[model samples]
Target chain A: METFKHLVNILAHPTIMLTVGMLVFLFFFPPNDWFEKWNRRLRLNFLWTKKGFYFVMFLMVVFFLFGLTDPNFSLIIKKPDNVPIIGLIFFVFIFLWISMNQALKNDNLIEAGEKPEEYNDPEDKVLVWPDLVYIEFIALILCMSLLLIWSIGLEAPLEGPANPAESPNPSKAPWYFLGLQEMLVYFDPWLAGVVFPSLIILGLMAIPYLDTNPEGAGYYSYKQRRLAIPIYLFGWMILWVALIVIGTFLRGPNWNFFGPFEFWDLHKLVPLTNINLSEIIYIKWFNRGLPENILVREIFGFLIVFGYFLLLPPLLAKTAFKKLHQNLGNFKFGFFIFLLLCMLSLPIKMYLRWLFNLKYLIAIPEFFFNI
Target chain B: MSDKKKSNIFQRLGESQVWKSIIRSGIPRTRRQRMMSVLNSVFLHLHPVRLPRHAVKVKFTWCMGGLTFFLFLVLTITGILLMFYYRPTVEYAYTDMIDLGEQVPLGIMREIHRWGAHAMVITVWLHMFRVFMTGSYKPPREFNWVVGVILLTLTLLLSFTGYLLPWDQLAIWAVTVGSNMARATPFLGHEGPGAALLALGDINFVNIGSDVKFALLGGRFVGEAALLRFYVLHCIGLPFIVMILMAIHFWRIRKDGGISGPT
Candidate 1:
């Protein structure tokens, strides 16, 4: 009795009460039934009721119990709107579920020819604290409810209808898309807004399938590997640098593609608008007699594409497997690397544009950086 | 007793002209029954039957993702309401937004739409990152992951298309950059080397070669036609597609079974 009292006193400190409550609930109700059902159906279980959810609740209550006792917690009121109505409906459903489940537990005990107290037996059960379990569940649901209401209420009402003529400076995308918009300044718009972004989406989506060897499916795959580590690090480093560089530089009039707008009175050096590409190509030995700039690019592009798509894949496959053809060849590692390269293409292209701008400035002193 | 109940129901259904009119929509009896079953049962309608709720339990987390979807639904409802007063033309687009903000009855609806969109993106990304951290993208669940990726792309596309509907200078220039980027895409692109390749003598022929510039702008760059196209995509085409994808995504979640990891 003294030990139990001491334990209760320690938990009552409020600094540890939430944690204590969480531990009690987890120790008692493990959500074993949920896991069993999940595993039976999917051959795996990830929804463990013992971790995180209860833990977060425990930490908050233990750490912030003082705050809750203060006036601030009271400020978290339910908003008066359709959101609250939906919340009310959810609350009702939760209550009904809890009541029915409790009743059903009692019914099962009775049907088994056991006393009602058996369901609540303290001696026979090692960690079966139903009260604690119920408390944790309710607390977690309340937290979610509070979060939903808070989200809805935080949104400010519209200031006015949209107007076109009075274009605001630093016209921004919604905060969510600001990251992508920031990329456009340094990159070719296609690279920033489309290709790289597309690759990221594709990469995320392909993760489950690309690594789907059914080996280490649920566990971290790259943790033990050193070979892929550098690549991942490099990819992330490049991404951050690209985002910061583009967002910071290459902004202002014309939404310039590199480090702000710079003067380039190139009409004096080379009359470009009416000039035929064939004349320039004929003058150059490397791209001799090409009718258009595209013709030269295409010729080189074909070589690179052919080598990459046709020759290299087969050569690598033959070297790795000692066989040219195989039914189960996925080239997962190669594809991963290829995807990474695709992701980096935007930043690289953006860099090239920056380089060109610098060269142009150097070539003609009059075409100096504006900033 | 059951026979009498069935007979009465059949007779009532037969006598109702509305039921006959519904049948003329070419809905087979089985399909009608299924839809009616969904509409009739409150709880069952929360989820469709074809979903293998049991199977997807292991490789899916139902909590945050579900919340995000709920938010998306809220945004859709509010967005549709705001669309009633929105004008996408450059001349009146910004004015419409101002009007929505200052005038229109319950103009707060427009604020909700804008804010909802911002919130939706945050939630969706959080959902995606959660899926990644949990290693939810493993075998048998790969296709669903692909679908999720497509959904992500569509989400961004929806954001981009919707951004231009305001028809302000910001909308105009931002979309100009965005569409120009689209035109630079290989094969079906309107610019870069691809455009020249598509040209045969004076006529540039192919999917994106001929009239590509005209089609995108509706006339020239960032004009009235562009705004209308963006408006339709934002309010109509993108939403419809997103809703369908969302439905499929949810169904797939159940089919794939819930979140992956150990208990």
Candidate 2:
């Protein structure tokens, strides 16, 4: 019993242990040399198709095993809270990785000006009705059958009648909104719930319009779209998915922080002493108290925020993203860069909230504005 | 019976004027007949006659879009069935749901409706992701992509508005947490950013009672009014909007050169 108890104690601390293990493993494991062996094997006549098939099978097996063995598997699926979101996030990442890997393999061929037929579908292609429709119809049947069976077994949750007087201690929005809900902890409600979400939607809408890249159409290729899609998806993972994971597994009652295996306690409060940049500058740099005027006090904040958002386009046009800048002219370039900065701000703010307890860059409580 | 006799019966049926009138053609033996089989049927006209062999490949397309449309059908059918037993009143809503699950005819319809709603949300997201990753939204297809985005938003809105219909704690709190965000819309909410500015010059242009939040909730808080509003939105309003948008979306896919293949 002691040994079993000790095993749970040691094994359940995945976050800390995994971080340590990863650092240690990476320090010794030179990834370039490891890949060189795979390259040599590939040159010795290993088929990429076979390799990819085996690799996917291997991943599926590993995932299946992990699900079976993970102690919190039940909690992850059975949800009144967001444990299922955590599970879905992991699965989503795995599929994303596989998709990226598949896309990457054909990237170089695309760059080398390979014909579309050589890589994927021929230009003069197949029909839509019998070919696509039959498969679609079959898929519809399979999906409906699966959902019906699952629904029969698992009833959707319905608790008692709502009484406005008794709100849940940590009332959650729907699983998708949990990411934004989590953000509300770090930023003001307006910024997290309203502005950032709007920005995400706007950015998504702007993708096809702004991204002038002519390659990676009708097929997936990481090389062809090495810049745009991956960067957007990676940012989405960090900002939204990561936040939801934290909100699901790491948050406890009273919106307190907790480790993965930590028990939720109503009173498990972590003392927060957050200070704004303006306040810090006022006291530390000028050796005086902060001003009451919102305009005077937050001018620096506005400059910092807008400057990063606005100025980066011209900077990119001159430097790292010059090609992109030329591809998409001034208007599109500025808009895209602005969207990127907004997306990037979520993670930046989250880190600041976590590390320094920095509440806001611009906090205007009089107008209920905190950013 | 002999194989020849069976063929004679089928041949006679195929040649009969009545059969010709219905089928507009004889038995489908040739490729042209196979193509006509799709064109001649009103129900089958939604599909293009014969697909490109490439279109059939599951991995390339992932069939995610089709899967989403299929799930929408499931949700619609099941939702209507569930609606037959449901009552939107605060007193009767939750009870009706329980009774529908336990005592009503095809009691499982309630469960199917609930689960199908969840599945619809998942499939819509997957479809959007698949489309984005494939870069199928470029050029003339851009507007279709925009329509797709609107449909996606409608999917979420439908799911959210439907969440409140159960009248349960989960439904209530979830919606409560969600609608509370509206109360922070810049010029709308009493406590929102632009509201203070709007309050100046001895006059208030906007406040909680007269803003987007009020219109959304139908009151200061989520209660009976909110439930009824959500019900209308979920069952009739949003669904009506989505149906029209989906029609346009599908039409545009055909117009935009069919599910974007390798060029």
Candidate 3:
């Protein structure tokens, strides 16, 4: 049991969890068809099948039941504010399973040179008065009943009165914004809070514009949009939902990590000797006093930041994203690549923070500017 | 005999001037009548007279969009009820929350409102996920998708603004942490990147007294003013904006050819 707890704790770490998420995504959606035969032989694609879904759900249920037996895990999971998050986790998985299951089925049909399931639907048109309206009415009633039950079962959280002086140990934002709060750990408030959020909204809005592919426009088919689907899943699952989970359950006193079975000890100290790029260059590597001039001091950091945003787009267009560039033209391709790079930067920054204890790429406290 | 009499009475009532004036098309019993029923009613007209059968499939759409709207309506209704007993002032805000939970009749209104808000957030996300997976945002639906993204942001903002209304330790701190991000709003924030550059001969334009954060909080910190501001945004300002955007979103769905289907 102790060993099991330790293993779970290790797996729960953001680095490990994200690595696993990437691997699983790759396993399910292999980049090349050459891996298909190997995957079939290994029966790995069974994970995307109905039986696999049920098996995974069973495992999740068992895990939850076992975790609930542990008081520490139960305490966190049973919290009023955390309850919706628990539901969110289940809902995300269930919905993902449902959509993926259908997509895979549709993919199979399309591969056999047949129309997708939606195309074969017999009743092409339906009356709004009875068909759609009936569904809407039923859904509304069902939703209302569910809300009533949920409200009755659990009381909304009401903590102590507002006292500015007395702060909570682990002050968390609302569950939805927890992802942004988690990002604050790695990036400055400007980048994490303001810039990234705007980019996310912009990127989502830009999807229709960027994705010029006419295929898979109105149906579920993974094979038709292998690239698009996986990228979206990665953003939604790992970047957004997983971060929320980490922020809600793992983050404890002073925003320290606490495993599900572990106690949130206030005094549990982890060494944090975060160094900026300028400090690393001047003080550590060169073994000299830092320059007085701000621009001169942070020249290396500035160069790297500029190179990443400015140079990388054209470079990537020539190399990795050549096909994408050809498809989306110049302006659209540039915008798409920029957004993609920005999205990828979050994980890159996180990895840097974990591996090197690096704080800011460009840290200029003179004007409170850091990245 | 009694059942016949009741039916006759209902039929007569349906044919009466008041009922005719209100219903226009009473008890739709034919195909044309069904279509007319949807067309004639203001509430029902939001949906088209006919839809692709697959569009009504629970498996495909997951009814997430409808549920999201339903949850929003629930939130609005319950929010109104809660507002009757709740006060936004710092002194009364915390006490008012306590009273709603403890003293008010049907105190569950607060719970329903809170949970409904959370549910709405989840449903909206799922709705987006569904739309993306189905590739419904393609072609003519592109602008609608952008509208949706804005709605998603507004939904989050609505929830975030409401988060401070309870005036509890959780509320104030969370808002403080959230609003603190405004302090780094590039050129606008006091501690932001270009704020220093905005200064002229030691006369700094952006500082603690005049920054985005100060504007957001109505002061340097999350106090009474901040609470009131958040309350107004939560209750009126954001919702009003959301309603306008939502109108465009729904209208565009019809204009863009009613939900996407297999091409």
Candidate 4:
């Protein structure tokens, strides 16, 4: 049990979790056909099949029940405010599994040169009065009953009255916005709170425009939209949902990370010496004091930041994303790549922070500018 | 006692002037009558008279969109009830919240409202996911997808603005942390990039007093004005916008060929 707890603690580390998430994602949705045999043997699609899904769900339930045995885990999980998140986890997974199961099945049928399950004869229609309306009525009743039961079972959380002077040790945003709050650890409020959120909305809106491929219209088929599906899952599952989970359960007092079974010791501190790019270049590498001039001191930092955004697009256009560029045209390609890079930057910055204690790429507090 | 007598009684009731005026469509027995039942009713008319069989399937639609709308209705009704006892002012807000749990009748409405709000957020997200997975946002439905993305943001905003209403530490701190982000709104914020550029040698344009954060909080900090502003935005402003957008979203579904299907 101790060994198991240790293993979980290591695995739950953000760096490890994120890396594992990416690996699992790639394993499921490989960039090439190289892992086809491995994928088949693993039965990636079978994981969403009824029997496989039940087994996975059983494991999750067991794990949760087991975790609840530990006081630390139970305290976090059983919190009234966190209850919706628990439901979110289950519902998200269930719906994801359901959709993926259908998608995989549809993909197989399409490969066999048949229509998807959603294909219905237009003439063979159902009246809204009974068919649609009845289903809606049933759903509404079910939802209402569920809400009533939940309301009766658990009380809504109301903490102490408004105290302006003393803030909570780990002040968290509402569950939905927790992902943005988590980003504050690795980024400035400007980038994490404002810019990324705007980009997310814009990018979601841009999906229909960007993804001009009309192969999988009105049906669930992963094979038809392999690229689009994985990218979106990465953003939604890893970036958003996973971040919220970490923020809610893992983060402890003073915004420190706590393991599932570990106690959230209020006094516990992790010593960190975060260093800026200028400090690394001037003081550490050159064995000299930093330059007095701000621009001169942060020249290398600015060059790298500017180079990443400006130069990398053309380089990608010529190499990796050449086909994408050709298909999307210049303007659309540039916009798409910009959005993609912005999304990818989060992980890159996170890795930099973890590995090197790198705080900022460009740090010029004179103008309140940093990246 | 006879089948004919029973039918006659129901038929007579259905044929009454009051029944006709209220129901418009008589007790639907035939296919045409069923279609008319949907067509004539204001609430039911939002849906088309007939839909492709697969469109109504739980597997395909997931009923997430409908549930989200239903949750919104639940919230609005419960919210209006809560408003009767609760005051948005800083002095009364915290006590009112406590009273809601202890003194108010059917005080469980707060729990339902809170949970329902959370559920709505989840449902909206899932709805989007289902739409994306099915490629329902293609071609004619592209604008609707954009509208949906906007609605998703509004849903989050709605939840966020409502978060501050309880006038508790959780509410204030969360909003404070959240609204503090506005202080980094590029040129308009005091601590943001390019704020210094908008200043003369001796005079600064944007500072703590006049920055975006100041405008958002209505002061330098989370206080009375901030509470009132967030209250109004939460109850009225955001919901008003969301309703308009939701109308457009539902309207577009009909215009965009009544939900995407394999062509």
Q: What are the clashing pairs of model 3?
A: none
The list of candidate 3 runs beyond 4 A from truth reads A31-42, A120-123, B1-13
Per-residue lDDT of candidate 1, residues A1-371 (tens digit): 34643444354432243234333433222234553354446532112233433454465455334333433222222112113322322332333233223333444454576543212222222211222223334544654465555544554422333444555444544433444676654444445655666677666665554443343233322222212322333343235322432333323233332211222122323222322222333434455554344435344434544465556555655774333125235576456546755655444444433343311101111211110
List model 2 lDDT by residue over A316-342, tens digit each: 789977877888888888888888777
Ranking by TM-score: 4, 3, 2, 1
Report the Cα lDDT for residue A20, model 2.
Answer: 52
RMSD to true structure for each model, in Å: 16.4, 4.8, 2.1, 1.6
DockQ, computed on Cα atoms, for candidate 4: 0.89
Order of candidates by lDDT, top first?
4, 3, 2, 1
Worst 10 residues of 4 chain B by lDDT: B1-10
For model 2, what is the error of residue B103's alpha carbon versus the real structure, in angstroms, after optimal superposition? Answer: 1.2
Candidate 1 versus truth, CA RMSD in Å, comes to: 16.4
Model 3 TM-score (2 dp):
0.96
lDDT against the true structure, per candidate, is: 0.48, 0.71, 0.89, 0.90
* Per-residue lDDT of model 1, residues B44-101, tens digit only: 4444433222213322332446556656766678787877887666677777777766
Q: Measured against the native two-chain assembly using Cα atoms, what DockQ does each of the candidate structures obtain, in the order listed?
A: 0.17, 0.62, 0.78, 0.89
TM-score of 1: 0.54
Candidate 4 per-residue C-alpha lDDT over A298-344 given as tens digits, one digit per residue, 9 for 90 to 100: 99988987898899999999997787789999999899989999999
Q: State the TM-score of the second chain for every model.
A: 0.72, 0.90, 0.95, 0.95
In terms of docking quality, model 1 is incorrect
lDDT of 1 at A25: 32
Fnat, one value per model? 0.24, 0.64, 0.87, 0.93
Give per-residue CA lDDT, model 3, range B164-243, as digits (tens): 99999999999988999999999899878898899899999999889999999999999989998999999999999999
